[model samples]
Target: MIQRISHFFTAIVHRILPDPLIFAILLTVVTFVLAFGLTPTQPAELVVLWGAGFWNLLAFSMQMALILVTGHALASSPLVKRMLVALASSARTPGQAVMLVAFVGAVACAINWGFGLVLGAMLSREVARRVKGTDYRLLVACAYMGFLTWHGGLSGSVPLVAATRGNPMEKTIGLIPVSHTIFTGYNAFITFALIVLLPILARLMMPRPEDVVSVDPRLLEEPPTVERTLSPDATFAERLEESRALAILVALVCAAYLIIRTIEKGFVLDIDTVNLMFLAAGMILHKTPMGYARAIGTAAKGASGIMIQFPFYAGIQALMDHSGLAGVITRWFVDVANVHTFPLLAFLSSAVINFAVPSGGGHWVVQGPFVMPAAKALGADLGKSAMAIAYGEAWTNMAQPFWALPALAIAGLGVRDIMGYCVTALLFSGLVFVAGMYLF
Candidate 1:
């Protein structure tokens, strides 16, 4: 039955899902229409909003691109590749391969989303290379299913924000600690459930042997080493480029900085730090500045989609936030919700709003003000309410391809290749999110 449902959704997505760029464009149109109709914002203002907000994510776009480049470089390093290969070799069958990829992706993303995205893609590629007869598309989708656990994990933005001082909701709900938000009994159930069950779900979704879409072994070949023998009398400039000493020195410096940062802020991670860590590690593992640089050059081609498509989603986020449409949507859910249902409804509303604002930090900003005050008034669990919003954002990402760009770029697959399976995951995981919010 699970396989049948997976097959059904896969077929539907293949038939209906357009290119991710087109999907983003279509989402923009839908957001425009919804915001215009639902809010008092006029057409002219909406136009300015869209155009003005289009460039808002330029910095974020750069970070994402770096994640692709740096992460690819790191994964391509001999040490990392060997590690991934060892893990991939553990799975003897396609089912085990799919399950392993899902579990690794979940654990990685739960630790840090940026790290998770790149590792998941790289691991999937390694798994595909070693696991013959595995469905390549299903492997990628299973990797992405691991993303659902992120918002409940240590690095989850909504929970982190709720726990922080002077957040927008700080005055209303005060500071809800991580113990209440991320470390709670209910959250544990949800995160553990997804971590444990999603792999099983992915295993179930595996296509039959004959039906499997196997990738070419040549395509999965490890990235070539950048190191090459230099002439005895190589020029100083050329030597500097390949200088292993320089790479080691730089990596050590970065290591010290990161250690200091960890000491100051515990384990808090953001995009820039993650990128730097990957960059430093890649440089060290590759054994030279030039080697890591060459690896980055090869990996950069994958970032083209991220560079072109993020602006469209940024515009949608602006339209959703500035137009008051996101707030209005949340209000609708809050209006219909009582104390018992507030968290569930908040999760649902965040799930809807996530289509426009597909970002973790962005979701908290858009949904926090409304959900926090309402939870306070209704005597609801503020920590759970915040988590509900986070869960919603993470849950719907399986349907929203906004976050999938990194994984797809690295895996060398199109959105359609993995989306059908992701849609299946989206449907199946909805039960976990709902149960987490209301039951525990």
Candidate 2:
């Protein structure tokens, strides 16, 4: 029955889902129509908002692209590849492979979203190389399923921002400490539940034997690096290009900076820090600066999807925020919610807004004004209220192709390839999120 359900969704997704760029374009049109019809903003104003905001995410777009490039380079290191191979070898059967990748993805994601996204994709490919007959798409989706817990984790933008001083909502709710937000009973329940169950759900969603789409090992295999043997009389520039000492010097600088920074401030796993760590690790592990550079060049090819599509999303977010469509949509949910129901409703509202904003920090920026005020008025738990919005954003991402871009790029797959299983994950995980809201 589970397999059949998986097959059903897979069939539908494969038939309907276009390239994610097309999906983004279609979403842009949908947002325009909704804003024009539902809000008081003028059509001319909407176009200006889109254009003005088109470049808004340029810094963010680079960060995302680097997340893919750096993470992939780190994973392509020889030591990391051997480690991945060892981990993959632990799972002999297809079922074990799915479960292992799912669990690993969740844990890594919980630690850091960027790490989880790339690690899961790389690990799944390695697992596929070893565990023949595992459904390759399902492995990638299972890895993505780890994302369900990201917004509740340490690097979660919503909770982290809420805990910081002078945040947008700080005036209203005061600073919500991590103890009250990320480390709370409810957040733990939700995160723990997903971490524990997502793998099982992934295993259950495996396609039937005949329906399985396994990848060829040759396609998944990395090509050998063809560095020529250097003569004893090699030129100074050539020697410097392959210098392990130079790579180690740069790696040490990165490590020293990160360690000192962490000691001075706090252990923050924001994108910049994560990317630096990946680059540093990759440099050291590759044993030479040029080898790491070659790895980065190879990995960067997968990142074109992220580089090209993010501006459209930025435009969409700008339109939704500037045209007041996001607030209008949030108000609809807020109007129906009371103290007891605000958490769930806020979660639902954030889920709706996610399609438009499709960002964690962006969700907080768009929904925080509307949500925090309503929560205070309705006497809802402020921490829970904030996390509810985070949960919704994270939950609905299973259905959205925005965040899936990084994982898909690394997996060498299309948006449709893993989305069918992701839909199933969204359903099962939705129950956990809803139940946690009710209980905590």
Candidate 1 per-residue lDDT over residues 1-440, each given as its tens digit: 88888888888888899999999999999999998999999999999999999999999999999999999988888888899999999999898999999999999988998899889899999999887889999998988889999999878998888878878878767899999899998999898899999999998898877778888666676667687778999999989988999999999999999899899888668788899899899989989888888999999989989988999988999999999999999999998999988888999999999988999889878888888899999999888888889999999999989899999988888898898889888888999988877777
How well does candidate 1 match the true structure in TM-score terms? 0.97
What does candidate 2's lDDT look like per residue over 158-179, in tens digits? 9999888888988877888889
The lDDT for every candidate, in the order shown, is 0.90, 0.90
Give lDDT: candidate 2, residue 178: 88
- Among all windows of ten consecutive residues in candidate 1, which has the lowest summed lDDT? 216-225
lDDT score at residue 54, model 1, on the 0-100 scale = 98
Clashes of each: 0, 0
- Off by more than 4 A, model 1: none
lDDT of 2 at 435: 90
